[model samples]
Target: MIAGLTWLVGFQLLGELVVRVLDLPVPGPVVGMLLLFAYLRLRRYDDSGSIVIAGSGLLRHLQLFFIPAGVGVVAFASVLGRDVLPVTVAVLGSWFLGLVVVGWTAVGLERLLGRPRDDLGDPPAEAAA
Candidate 1:
C-alpha cells in the first residue's frame, strides 16, 4: 500500500513538473492520470497489482475526499448566495447540454450498430397484421 501510494504521488509530482516546465493549460492531476494509464497499459499490470489495490482502497473511501470541497462550499456560502442565479443557470444548462449530447450519442451508436429500438419490437404493418 505504501509503495502504491508512493507511485501515485510520484506520478502526480512528475506530472506537475512536466506541466510547469511546458507551461501547459491542463491540470497536473489529469496529466498524471494519463501518464499512469499509459504506463499501466505498457506494463500490462494485473488487478492484483499494488497500484490497483491502492486505487481500489482509495475509491472505497472516495466520499472522504469530498470533505474539503464541502468545507469550501460552506466557507464560500455567502459568495455562492450572491451569485446563485448565474450558478443555477450554468449548472442547469450544463446538465441539459450533457443530457442532449448523451441522448444523441446513444441514438447514433444504436443506428451504427444496427440495433432495433426497444419501443419498435415489431414493425407497424406486422403489428397491424
Candidate 2:
C-alpha cells in the first residue's frame, strides 16, 4: 500500500516536473499521462499489477476530483455567460479550422506522393509503349 502511494506520487512529481520545466500549456497530470504513455510504449511494461490496477482505480474515480472545479465554474457562470457568444464562435471556428488544416495537410502530402486515394491523384503520365 505504501509502495503504491509512493509510486503514484513519483509519477505525479515527474509529470509536474516536465510541465513546470518546459512550461507546457497543459496541466501537469496531462503531461504526466503523455509521459507515462511514452514510457509504457518504450518499456513495454504491460502487467495487471499495482501500477495498472491502482492507476485505473484512480482514473475511475477521477471525475469526483473535478467536482470542486465544476463548482468553481458554477460560481463564475455569469462571467462566462457574458462572453459566451464570442467564445463559442472562436472555439467552434478554431476547432473546425484545426480539423480542416490537419486534413488538408495530410491530403496535400499524400497527393504530392501520388497516393491516388481520397481524390489525391498524381499528374497524368505518358502512355506506355
Candidate 3:
C-alpha cells in the first residue's frame, strides 16, 4: 500500500516539476495522470497487480478529495452568493448549448449513416383492439 501510494504521489511530483520547469500552461496533476496512464498501459499486469490494486484502493477514497474544495466554497459563500446570477446563467447556458450541439450531432450522424427516422422510435404497438 505504501509503495503504491508512493507511485501515485511520485508521478504527481514529477509532473509538477515538469510543469514548473517548462512553464507549461497545463496543470501538473493532469500531466501526472497522463504519465501514470501511459505507464500502466505499457506495463499492464506487471508487479503482480500491486499497482492496479493500489490504484483501486486509492480511488476508493476519492470522495475525500472533494472536502477541501467544499471547504473553499463554504469559505467564499458570500462571493458566490454575490455572483450567483452570472454563475447560474453561465452554467445553464453552457448546459443548454451542449444539449443542442449533441442533439444536432446525433441527428447529423444518423442522417449521414442513412438511418430512417422510424428506426429512432420504439417498436410499433399492436393496432388498438
**CA lDDT, every prediction?**
0.90, 0.79, 0.86
Per-model TM-score on C-alpha atoms: 0.75, 0.57, 0.68
Whichever of 1 and 3 has more lDDT, that candidate is 1
Candidate 1 Cα misplacement greater than 4 A, ranges: 81-83, 106-110, 113-129
How would you encode candidate 3's per-residue C-alpha lDDT over 9-127 as one tens digit per residue? 89999999989999999999899999889998887757566667788888899999999898997788787767899998999999999999998899889999998375536564674
Model 1: lDDT to the true structure: 0.90
Candidate 1: 10-residue stretch with minimal lDDT: 115-124
Which stretches in model 2 have alpha-carbon errors above 4 Å? 23-25, 88-129
How would you encode candidate 2's per-residue C-alpha lDDT over 1-129 as one tens digit per residue?
Answer: 456556777877899998899888888877777777787788876776566777777788889998988898778878876789999899999999999999899989988998847353654566332
Residues 1-129 of candidate 1 have per-residue lDDT tens digits of: 988988899999989998999999999988899999999999999999989999889889989999988998778878776789999999999999999999889998999999837786666896789
lDDT of 2 at 58: 79
Sort the predicted structures by TM-score, highest score first. Answer: 1, 3, 2
Name the weakest run of 10 consecutive residues (lDDT summed) in model 3: 120-129
Per candidate, the number of residue pairs that clash is: 0, 0, 0
lDDT value, candidate 3, whole model: 0.86
What lDDT does candidate 2 reach at residue 51? 68
